[model samples]
Target: MRHRHAAAGPRRPRLPLRYLLPSVLLVVVVVMLLLRGYVHSEFLADHRVRPPAPTGTVPEKVLSGGPVLDARGETPVSHRVPDHKIVLTFDDGPDPEWTPKILDKLAQHRAHAVFFVTGTMTARYPELVRRMVEEGHEVGLHTFNHPDLSYQSSARVQRELAQSQLALAGAAGVHTSLFRPPYSSTADALDDRSWPVAREVARRGYITTFIDTDSEDWARPGVDEIVRRAMPERPGQGAVVLMHDSGGDRSQTVAALDRMLPELRAQGYEFPRLTEALGAPGPHSAVHGTDLWKARAFVAAVGVSESAMGVLVVALAVVGVLVVARFALMLLLSAVHARRVRRRRRGRGRDGRRPQVTEPVTVLVPAYNERECITATVRSLAASDHPIEVIVVDDGSTDGTADLVEALGLPGVRVLRQPNAGKAAALNNGLRHASCDLVVMMDGDTVFEPSTVRELVQPFADPDVGAVAGNAKVGNRRRLIGAWQHIEYVMGFNLDRRMYDVLRCMPTIPGAVGAFRREALWRAGGMSDDTLAEDTDVTMALHRHGWRVVYAERARAWTEAPETVKQLWSQRYRWSYGTMQAIWKHRRAVLERGPSGRFGRVGLPLVTLFTVFAPLLAPLIDVFFVYGLVFGPTLRTAAAWCGVLAVQAVCAAYAFRLDRERLTPLLTLPLQQLLYRQLMYVVLMQSWITALTGGRLRWQKLRRTGLLGSAPGALSGSGAEAREPHGLYGPGEAREPRTKSAVG
Candidate 1:
């Protein structure tokens, strides 16, 4: 045995070098693969999941009435708006190729129909959606994809619903309380998950669709039958007739719509979305059917058909690229603006010295339902170091804002209690009462530093400067939410103000602390009530009249931010929607009104990109990134994505670095990259939708007092904290504080 073993060892000593080399190479390759997988999994895990309820809606009490809906809350309703007045609903589209033809036909016959489109579909054809809105067609949602609601998880169903909701909002400029589930199915099986989904949606204030009739065009019916099915002989009240626009060969359906839309209009059927129906009283007063059946049909039909996911993916990518490019251009513009400022300063030389002041200053504080913060704000104003006269315009605040202001026992702080006109009206009233040469408008919730008035007025020393925008600092930032707002204020609003200064085409002089020449404001006809963004409206007005708006970075105002996400959402929604209204109202200047119209060529475009396209693209990129990581070839994309992400992270970090105290919230920045950022996109899209539909801009008040009383992990309105000052300069120490109260 020993001899045999020795012989075998001798034989092995003659082994080939090739075998040894191959063995070593194979081991190295395996090790590298393992390392790669580990890195990917770790990074993916880090960047994929959202933190515990960092962003969410406040659980509002259900608006009483309407049957409770299912998981995919497509409730059935019996409200018929009359068979002859059949409203044609084309869902899942606004297809560019087909929808335009449909629109032309409808326009030719002076007809209108409701389009309940999928997010995927609308995104692919934003122009078509815009056309629908421009042509006066109602746009609703048919879910993001055509996923069967009955079989999907509640989370999946909600995501789907949100997809369409966001798409219609982002693409078509419409917000509807109505939604239709895929395949006309509802998740109403009394499942534990389904009920919550339904409840959550209803709590968010959406009315579930209840289709009273179906055209069955999705079933490949002949054009004649489709037309016949859609055209009810006596179109009943609240009837939502359904048909498809994008799924497969809808030419026949389109043709059918072309022929039948005019006929139906001739019959006196008013085509209104389920949204309009929800606003008005319907046939059923919220209780004619069982919950399950009610969820199944809600006197509406969402014409849904599937589109290839690829199209949406590509469209989203294109939109995203455009947004990113626009952002880059904006940054460049900011840089250019800074250079121009430098050049102008050098050119002016000794004339840059501050001039002696002879102008009277009137500070207008518009008060809404802000009783809690009104006294503090007014007191701060009274304590200002500058010579000032104060006027507090209470815009029908039921919270006794006027009473509190009147009782403040401060001179020169006169309270003007008016009926519930908008902020625009309040501003106009303030302007009329102002006897000062310089008018400073402030939000009632914001308090100013003593030197703020002086600094704000300094820019007005340059007669060319029509308005001066003061820097806004977060007044309450003790909690994480406040800290988050601190970052937002410093990074988003503050930085933009600086950039705007460089550009000399400032889009807005925030109401929190804005200074304008009394003559300039008067010349512009005060503030236009037609637009919601009064500050932006006046800014545009000044620009249109060949005036320059300057940003006063040194002039600072402190304001409280909404402590809850719901409050934040409501506030932001109003701001965004109002801004859009302002843009639309001033759209005429976008083209060549002349070289004097610098606003249309530069400022207006800047506003559009910053507010609209940036939001649109940011979310789309997030969606694409998620999909690529989840489904694409693994490990390879990691390097590329890391580079892109690195740039983004660096940019974001730099953006907030100016306010170091608030920079800590950047740690949560990565967390938002996972999901919360995407949610923001959804909210932005919804705001756009509501704007397009002419939804009321009336402020929806958020309950704020019980923030600290709630539990942290309660999944409700928890995570609330006590209000306190926070951000770059630390707590409670104002950089400047001034008081002056002079009655006119």
Candidate 2:
């Protein structure tokens, strides 16, 4: 039986214009690529790129460039064949639009015209070539790529003609002894310089063709202008008229033909094919079957190369858009955050400290093969001003991580051990074992500031506040890459956190240091394993469940960032992929009608735009910048790129100011943009591609260096990697931190 509301199934949301536009662009790019070779050889032929020899001026005379001569230096075909008739000749096309229309007009007037098409265009539109031949129109050679023959050697000219012959044979199964050289715009344009090419055509038994009258239709002049240029002023004997069917818009040429053909016939002039008017020897041989197959295969190869170039152009455009948008949005959002920070400071008393909380809280330290910095992290947590119960949950560490914590003998500190589970699973287990109403979680590689736990837990004093996001600083910023990451964390991550706080869609509370109300965590179904970004996933779940999440700027944690590019890629790949997964998992929240809806509609979209769209587009900026440096107005392109860099610098400055960080890293901003920025976009794209392909999203852990320090400048040098701060546990004695597992 059908339910009462069965008729109304949930309607899927429409794809955004951004996605649709790119899809259309991608299709156009693909199609263009398939015709890539054709475009280059034919469309770009007239540009005179890379001629074989120097192009000197060609002058018109008795032996102008176009016509072929016999062994006795006379015309191959007598021009004055018969009076009261004209030979109509066309060149350059077989264009999709104009060629067919021209063919239709000729059929209507019961006339025949010879179409001299370049090899590239013939291969691209073979049907047009076949159709012209089937309709009683003759076909002639116009070279393969249309390079200026005057600048070519005898061999090059021969090769050009042969290729066109093969192309015509393959396309329409005919090998006529007719030829026209490129750059021979008119009979007058050919001169002594063009003799070698004409001789080469004659050597191949071809009657080199030229026109007595030019239509000038390739210029796309108006219909009247074309007719005026093409038609003879008075009736003439055996006049050969030239026109084109391609290369540009040919509407005017078609219109001119429509008017000229009828009027010419009205004056008792008959249109004859070139062979009929000028005469030609009979066919020596039909198109060879082997040559036809070779021609088709050769054209297919050209199409592939064309497609590749087109795809590249489109990709560059997309990346350019992404990069520019990222810079603009970052600047705007960071400025808003920085201004808000200043206003808040002005409103508060000096130092702007919130009242210290005295409540006891449970701290969950989840360790997984983390032996280097676990001691420092636990020590830092133990020294918090507020009373706290430390629960060290070791998720099957081979390095005896739990034993070291238990051996420390700190008061109110306990250890729990479990099989190797992921961070999310370990956290869920820890959450179950904790007894306090408020809980704080920290990564084993992270060391909290003395007052971090206190400030993080303070937000829980209000029943409405469910979780507090802490400021996560890079603890290993001594390397060039590390310094770049420090800048990113302070600017891109922290500043964005401030904005998200104001927007009430705090997407993530970093696992390094975050405080949560235990009941709220339980209400949101504890930690979920659905996304690689477990912290972000859970926080978003809380928002959907109507819990207020805010950033606690005063709460700081020094966490080790990835030190190498390989590590960084792996870490970010997981992070970005997981974030996408979480966003999708909670996608329905956009329609939940309250806080979740606001977050989905507002925060989720913003996250997608910046994280996915912006980064995806960012690389195009560099592609163009590099391209311009090589082949374009270098100074202007550089200035435009620098302008974008300036915007980024301003945003970074504001973000550093808000984080109360030094401006030293700004020195590396240019280098970072050139190198690090591209890497990040690649990581983002690779991760998203992985997600789309349904590849496994595994957890990757960065090797802990245990170099994090509490004071400023501690993360600035190679010396910081000496050892962990061990003086807190004893006097003048330091031992390598150890790890061991326990049942309870």
Candidate 3:
């Protein structure tokens, strides 16, 4: 009905250029602004980094140097990638903000410098440490207590250094591999300044830095006097200048930076991170220098020219685009296939001749403590408008389900009783005595339409179709939560049906309303109680045996949805976990040649990537766009982000249009991006861990809302078939000829 109405809507005409010109102009302006921002950020990042360079001619100088391991051998401290370098040193400071202010000034010039931070100051202002790393600055360790090196004992110094290292690691994600001694001068009496501290730092893999130049007035001097004092000694190649950002007001130092940083970067300085300057790849792979190096290496290894490498990168990107396009095309094709199959099956013959088919259906409804709804189930079945033997399996229902069935006295409505075995077990027991050519499985809580049974059974007219699933709609969608679920059901189940129609691989035939051939169900073992997701398990089992499962969208049922966040979470957790379990159980058939192997080349990857990776990628995509906004290389970077966002919006809009929903929820897509989607990760992680540990989890019972709560019709009292001797409680009560029996 919904589909028919959608088709009837007046077609919207395409807008003319006059209508679109403003939009185009707006887009262009946005692109230009983004590009401008990107360029500015790149320039600022390039300019602010530092290690003072050789003065006379080369503005930005690159130098290679390292720690003298034994004052005899240069131990490699950092492995600088070409065009990127790191500067090494200590901070907090000389009990001084002057040290850090000077450091900040160097950073403005785009020079890399390491700050071995004191534990005391780090504790006071850890934000500075975090900002340093976040802004591509390296953090090293100064001592914990920040005592003068000459006054501290060997053991005391070691303890202080260790504590500081641990503190830095814990607070700022920095594991210090370098240390700087206080004052950069050793005391001879105790060898406290160098030997002992050096040994302790070296033992922990720290490369201690020896500063080549000091402004000296760190102890005392006027800002102007200090600038004059420090300006004469021009920095040579790889010169480490000591400075501070904490401990004192160093406004003078800040003043001098306006003169020094840009002048120096303008002089040709490459400010690499300390680690990069010392010749090591930085933490993230996005760093320009490292990516270029890796690309070069890959090209070299493949014996490809630079031009070939460029071609390969372009080819890889193009392939990704092609794959995504193919996937979308395949989805559309599947939808068309499903629609055709449905139309063919549904089309009645001319002259109105009845088709010669007398296959009776045994509809099984499994209920647990569902006395209130059991009557509805029986009444709906009695009203099915098709010949169906309704069997309600009462799985340990302490409620008056049996009493209610006896009172209803409905013909062809039977009640089968069993212990509190799970739904799967109850269904299996009920199936044993089914005694019909076709079987339909449903939940006691659902109420089916009068035409549901007829529509559901229509698909079975084709021998190729083993099972058909009915469209399950939210029976109570007045509340926000239920409405959300209604939308989700339409998107997930409906979308899947379309895809399956094309691929002929239906991953699930929901237990709520699935019709199956009795023989097919028997061939595949009857539902087992082991898996939490019995419906998914059974569907996969049937699919494994080369049976075609289908969707009967017009065969509708109204069922309950979780009404609260907690209930919804619990239901989804079980569902997600169960789906994963079913997938794992049938993993071999995923990509292997067999009756169940259709999904290997396409379906499996699609399912895994879309269901699993898509949620994870959501956060990353968000971060990427935000980063581009904050620190884009050129205005084009911002424009690229807008392009990405625009494309996503279009795709989402198309999906929503296909599903036939109101426009209000479409706006919630971005809100879902902020909160709802993140829940996927939490559920996935939990489900994965549960699977790994083989932990048995109890079924999460969703609390009732009673919003659309109406009592179901009573069940008809019936016992198991005598011929098969399959009773509800146990197998084979008394062997006899198998015949259909609907008894109370």
For 83-140, candidate 1 gives per-residue lDDT tens digits of: 3344557777767677787777777776667776776556556668778777767665
Cα error of candidate 2 at position 11, Å = 41
Clash counts for all predictions: 46, 18, 55
Best by lDDT: 2
Q: What's model 1's overall lDDT?
A: 0.60
**Alpha-carbon runs more than 4 Å astray in model 3:** 1-331, 338-358, 590-592, 599-605, 616-664, 709-744
Model 2 lDDT per residue over 1-744, tens place: 000111224333433442244445435544554356344553334455332333353323433433322322444432443566767888887788889999999999899988989887887777899898888888888888888877677877777777787777777778877777765744444445675666667767776677667888888778998888777646754567889888888888888888998888887889977667656553224666677678777666555555566666676666556655655665666566556645654656343644556878999988876777777778777667788999998887777689888888999998999876667788888999998989999888887766777767766655788999998888677689989999888878887787788777888889888999999999999988778888999999999989999887767778888888887987787788888888899999878798889888988887887777777666556755765565446899899899878877987888776666778878999999889877777677666656665665445566655665342222322112222222233433344543321211
lDDT score of residue 333 within candidate 2: 62
Q: Against the true structure, what is each candidate's TM-score?
A: 0.53, 0.77, 0.53
lDDT of 3 at 524: 81
Candidate 3 lDDT over residue span 618-675, tens digit each: 4434443444566654477567555654554554455445544444554555555445
Q: Which stretches in model 1 have alpha-carbon errors above 4 Å?
A: 1-310, 330-350, 356-358, 634-642, 657-662, 702-744
